[model samples]
Target: MLGNSLASSPLATLGLAKCFHHSAGEFATYTNVLPLGLNSSHHGLTGGVGTSRNKWIVVCSTTQVETSSEDPKTWEECKEALSCFDFSVEEKDKILGKAFGHIHSPYWTEERAKESPKVETLNQILEFLRSLGLSDEDLHKVVKKFPEVLGCSLEEEMKPNIGILENQWGITGKSLRNLLLRNPKVLGFNVDCKGDCAAQCTRCWVRF
Candidate 1:
């Protein structure tokens, strides 16, 4: 074991920090990401197990959505499979007991945008969450409230990976993260890489 923070971190353990930092870049600067397990995956070596976040706090959307996955990679397929639905925010309790935002949206068909009254929103909530380095417990709570605004929505066509979500995941986490990075408007989630931006992103992530 290379190291372990009181909280989890992408590079918590020196065991994989050297390699993980080289690839994922900005997604590993945090002090809360844990190396739940080891993997001798694709590179003929260890890869992220992707099971650490096996449980999710499913964020409920105010509109009709077929939420099959929230993994980065699978999100594309989900959007493609999606048919347009009128946007609306759902009601839910607070997370970390901190006041979170969820504005009502008459964000309806392209036709209604001009007429409907706009409201406050959580467009950048995910970014704030990542910056704070919230614990899994808090994260699960946050995700559970905003199904409409997932940090990373899954692709409708991605294959299921039970080892990842432990729930009814017909998709994987990598796919979900992909979706998160791609759809910044929904969550504004950033991938924190280590070494390069570690010093800077860390300061920003914390200060924010």
Candidate 2:
């Protein structure tokens, strides 16, 4: 039920990775994502600032004939799309494992992995979390309990919320990291809204 609760929460909704299944066009296992007249270096999923929006877009190369399938029509297609990333088998297993097994439901199958956070993105998030001084086990626990945190933006979401916890609620250093390990979902609250992160954190802290 933790997985289901996370999947439906606003924090998860804000940070959860989106898959290409929502697209109106046909689905292809290896759809070319290049922008019109742009080379691969200048196309989709680029890391450089101003190169592209921080969202994923599925596009077919101009040279390829469009397929007729409206979407990922089968489990195989969904698996292919999700596994097309550059990550290795071990990494894929980790992500998908946490997604499917952690939740103890068929809710997030391969279809969900296709749209879940990229391995690289998840690794970046993990790296930032590590800097917070959490042990490997605690770090894994945080992610396993709240896998949706993988989709959060380092600057916009994670750091800002952590900042609110520290600045407003005085949850600094080890105490903060420990708090997160206890309940990573606390990071999902929008500290920028209403009374902001502090007020929200206050409410949660008292209950925590």
Candidate 3:
């Protein structure tokens, strides 16, 4: 599902609106997100950057307490921890989002280098994209043009495609190809906001 959050950089969101040619911020629903503090706090999720890196990002105020308490627990535990009165609903939403975003099946979390690519399935997906009128040249152009800044390979980032492994990289898959075809812009990726937004962006919050 697409979100209307201005959390994305202006250029990307604007370009997306222009591409789809519709205004949709109010129509889009906010995903689950929660704020959390550093590992020293009681409510923060545990794990190292190397573990969760870029898989999910958290936005929180500096005054908030960060904790690793939720890190060691399962999703059920994390869900409960989010209700503690020490934090507000808005704050809890942010932290929960990060953990949820990063919580993949143990299979996906393994070192990507060691995993085998789903070559056969990827080929069929690639064929599907081609049938949709996306040319080989276009696919190459789009994937290469985007650089998939957010994923190790576009396929690794999402289970739906193999195109991410391509782009001239040794990877391969087709599920990603379809996903990219759907949201080609995201293939370009973005850097983390580091939980701070110094650049003002028209009070992007709903402030509900």
Give the number of the best model, judged by lDDT. 2
TM-score of each: 0.18, 0.42, 0.21
- Report how far residue 128 has shifted in candidate 2, in Å: 0.7
lDDT of 3 by residue, 1-208 (tens): 2455544523223212111111223221112212221233422332212122112222233322222322222322433432423444333433333222232222223422322223343344345545545676655544333322222343433323334235634433454455555555443232233447523221111110
Which sequence of candidate numbers ranks them by lDDT, best first? 2, 3, 1
lDDT of 2 by residue, 22-106 (tens): 2334333322222222233333232111112222223322111112233322212322433434443334334443443322323
lDDT of 1 by residue, 1-208 (tens): 3344523763233334222222223432211112324322222222222333321121222221111222322322222222122222222212111121222222111221111111112323433444434444444444554333431223321112212222444433455444334332233223234435544341122221
C-alpha lDDT of residue 52 in model 3: 28
Compare candidates 1 and 3 on lDDT and give the better one.
3
lDDT (Cα, 0-100) at 190 in candidate 2: 43
Query: Candidate 2: worst 10 consecutive residues by lDDT?
Result: 46-55
Candidate 1's C-alpha runs over 4 A off are 1-73, 76-128, 151-208
Best TM-score among the predictions, by candidate number: 2
RMSD of candidate 3 to the truth, in angstroms, is: 21.8
